[model samples]
Target chain A: MKILVPVKQVPDTATQVKIGADPKGIDTAGITWIVSPYDEYALEEALRIKEKQGQGEVVAVTVGPERAKEALRSCLAMGADRALHLSDPAWENADSLTVARALAAVIKQEAPPLVLFGRQAIDDDMGAMPAQVADLLGWPCASWIMEETISEDGKSVRAGRQVEGALEIFTIPLPCVLSAQKGLNEPRYPTLKGIMGAKKKEIKDVKAADLGLAADGAQLLVVALEALPPRPPGRIIPGEPAEAVKELVRSLREDAKAI
Target chain B: MQIELSEEQQMIQALAREFAEKEVKPVAALLDAEARFPHETVKRMGELGLMGIAVPEAYGGSGADTVAYVLALEEIAKACASHAVIMSVNNSLYCDPVLKYGTDEQRKKFLAPFASGQQIGCFALTEPQAGSDATNQHTLAVRDGDGYVLNGRKVFVTNGREAAVALVFAQTDPAKAHRGISAFLIERGTPGFLVPKVEDKLGIRASDTAEFVFEECRVRAANRLGEEGMGFKIAMGTLDGGRIGIAAQALGIAAGAFDLSVAYAKERKSFGVPIAQHQMVQWMLADMATAIEAARLLIWRAAALKDAGRPFGPEASMAKLFASEMAMKATTDAIQVHGGYGYIKEYQVERYFRDAKITQIYEGTSQIQKLIIARHVLGAR
Candidate 1:
């Protein structure tokens, strides 16, 4: 069986974000980039699935500019067998669906048994890849997948998904898309040997045009972005216990609208 | 000049950093308070190829360079100095010497296991009477046919208790003074070789600093490392690399403290505002950041020189001296930045302050480093 993982690199969660001068995006200066934390779950699940089967290939694919190659390399370091990077100048302004379409094109060529994705990219919080890619391919997909197992026969998938307050189980057929949720699995750190091996193998690059797709012309344009307004100052109720409690409750309900 | 780490180096550093943050830091205080060795994390480190970062792959090591080793060591040190020193001893003190000076046969035996992380190794050089005056001859190895009978006491030996093998230095010819010293690879469980004591320390309390006593111990002449008088040269060269590890550890300790202070200053309020807004606190934070960067550069230069196979003795000494002193000053001010909270055990800056002192004291004290630097600059012994 061949498993493919689609990954994205985003700013580390620890970054102090500042709105860029253009007001449409955050400042990129001094920001450290990392594999999206949720997507890290996707990589972990793919690697784990490969380990359990004991006989399969794990390929990681990504669609982004040159910097996205680092994310693929990181996946390789984390024990992915191969990396396929989709690069194109037109991809610079492509919308979410365009990116998904390009990935779907690669998916068709590889024709892997399973494709794993993070439920959402932390940067965009779209949570749209599995649905978009699966819709493009006309295959069944389950998003927010928390638990999964491939049958011994390797012809079907037993998956558990996150819901309002409980798990929803589904026995989906073979060759499906699954978006990993937080509890899917714990990710492993890239070992030293794996890192050296990651350096040895070359990442295969592909052009969107070669895939017979127009990468330009985004479907949706991002309007002006706004920074969150500064928080109001804290207030201390200046009274003893009895009056302070009443005043605090009154202020919470009437002035702050918190109650 | 900016030092750029290669991708492999960055990954190794990141792995170590993640390990430190997730595994080492959470248990650091408990381990320190209990004075317990971190067996679980150390074992994981070995498995991750951190224990033998600079050792070659052929000998079961990760086969990276000195720069990579220091980068990993600094990250571990940032979370817990104890873990850092344990890694440092195995890499620099035990595995390094055996790899460089041991024959292939000896390498297979001594270097492979430690570098592979299956076993730990230690250096037995600092005896009760041989602290700064390491030339003092107290340990003896008397030739008994093709083997030798050894007797000595080695103190302040890092990783001494848990190490599977020890590289012991002893006097073979009394008249030759320091030249008489011969190094031997002695495995644990050898009859008459014993760990008589383990010290409870001022800092890095999680690591075991032990005293090994040898009485009527026997070893094959084949176990000897290099020529008999070459022991002094081996020990000095080993310390050169060991000093670099210590410098990185010191830098990490200070960097860790500075991070705490910076985060604390932003949230900790005094005089109706965050302490970070105050001029005095800003000065402290600025100085800490600048000193840490400066210390890191020195350490990088020394590590780079070693990687390039150039002479880095004086440079290593300089790095150790400056970084250790800077750690002291940085940790002190870190505690000062936290004010009353820093004075308590619940806060971490106090621990950093305590841990910083030992860096100045061990792996050749700050004074010793200055002397080496001074001697090198003056072209005098």
Candidate 2:
């Protein structure tokens, strides 16, 4: 079985965000990059499935600028057999639809048995790409898959997902798409040998224009961007243990109204 | 003593555990069975700034504190004890002494490679007759003109077969007894110094234990650590740092055993319900958890003291004694919880049980720890 995992590189969100001076985006300088947190889950699930089958290659695909090679290289280091880079300047400000269109063209060409992606990119926190790609591929798709198992005959896969406060298991046919959720499996780190090997693996880069995508389709568009509201100042309440607990409960119920 | 780890220390523990489980654990058993070092894992750890965790950044190390180093060793040891001991000896015995006492030239030449993991190191103090009686050294270092001629045999030297440099202890003044000892930097392949044999050990099988014979091994006087009569102090101080590493190793071994036992208890069934439902099994887990927490607190307290430049002699001894004993008991009980499956090698609890015994023996035996602690308590030598 051939598996393809689409990974995105985004600024590590856990780090303190340095808002751009313009207040519309993040400060890019010196910000570290990580494979989209959700995407790591996706890659891990794909690797797990490949290992269980004991056959086939787990390929990685990414749509980004040239600097994005670092994230792709990391995927290979983490045991992905091959990588495909869909490089296009148009992708810089492209919305989810255009990005999905570029990936769909590559998927059709590779014709992998399955496709996987993270639920969202931690940077944008959009949570839209997977479903968009699945729609573009015209295949059965499952999002937020917490557990997955392929059938003995390879005809179908069963996926468990969180829904409405419970886990709902679904069975989907082959040639499907899956968006990996957290708690699926732990992702492996790249070993020194794996890092060395990743440097040698071929990364095929094709222009979005070459995939018969229209130049206008590649046209970048950002309607507007704005900063989120700053979090309220923290308040610390100190008192006796029981009194503190009671006060905390009162604040949550009356002030925050979270209870 | 302050028993909590700083934020940096906690980060090191998390990072090391992530690296070991993801990069090292997959191959630990295979490498141990084949008696092969996991070179790739070690190299990767070096890249992650782990090998010389406690070494200062100025000397090609990560400059992390003692607690961080201890935490990192614990994670690595949980995956493979052999690699952990190698790391411990290099950081505590070889690189640390040079950084603490060496000339600028020596730090640049000898300390850099070991700290950066470009080369390995070993510590040679235990002669065949001087296992626990460390002061009774038979090795001799005689001044011959501008150099010192070293002649002796060092047995059970951890990492001896693979080390590029060895911090060797020899008697420089027999009349001074313990104060007579002096340390020398013996580079491997020095003329007249040879690795005669590597011992096959019951545990940490992947780590090479070898004997060295030094026959008229001439080293420049510049290589001596500190001054005459400083070897015993160097050896003891080195072991004080080493004890923390051993304590961390013990904690890791116990953790590995405890995790496996917990999983087994929740799944394995004897009388319809899961084995974890039994009261005795619950007691074992509760005791293990409580002991492990206490052990971690003590180990961290000692590490914090060392980092703070305080004398941690007593705390180090106490932590080592408690953690090693805890590991022995925990691994044995892990086997008991597994019942018959634990008796076999396939289940791996038996291996953990076997591995846990050595932590108590090496890095000062449990008896020696008691002596140190009691001496500290009574203000006696």
Best by TM-score: 1
Instruction: Write model 2 residue lDDT over B1-381, tens digit each, in one string.
Output: 344555345445666877878777777777777777667777767766677777876787777778888888888888878778888888887888888878898898889888888888889999999989999999999988888999999999988998999999999999999999999998988999999999877788778889999998999998897898899999999999899988988988898888889999999998999999999999999999899889988998899899999999899999999999999999999999999998887787776787789999998999999999999989996
TM-score of chain A of 2: 0.85
Q: How good is the docking of model 2, by CAPRI class?
A: incorrect
List the candidate 2 regions with Cα displacement exceeding 4 Å: A1-259, B1-7
Candidate closest to the true structure, highest DockQ: 1
Q: What value does the lDDT take at residue A203 in candidate 1? A: 95
Please write out the lDDT profile of model 1 over residues B129-246, one tens digit for every residue: 8888889969999999998999989999999999999999999998999999989999899998999899988899999999999999999998999988888889999999999999
lDDT of each residue in A130-222, candidate 2, tens digit only: 788888888989898889999999989999987878889999998999888888887766533354356678788888777888645533455
Clashing pairs in 1: none
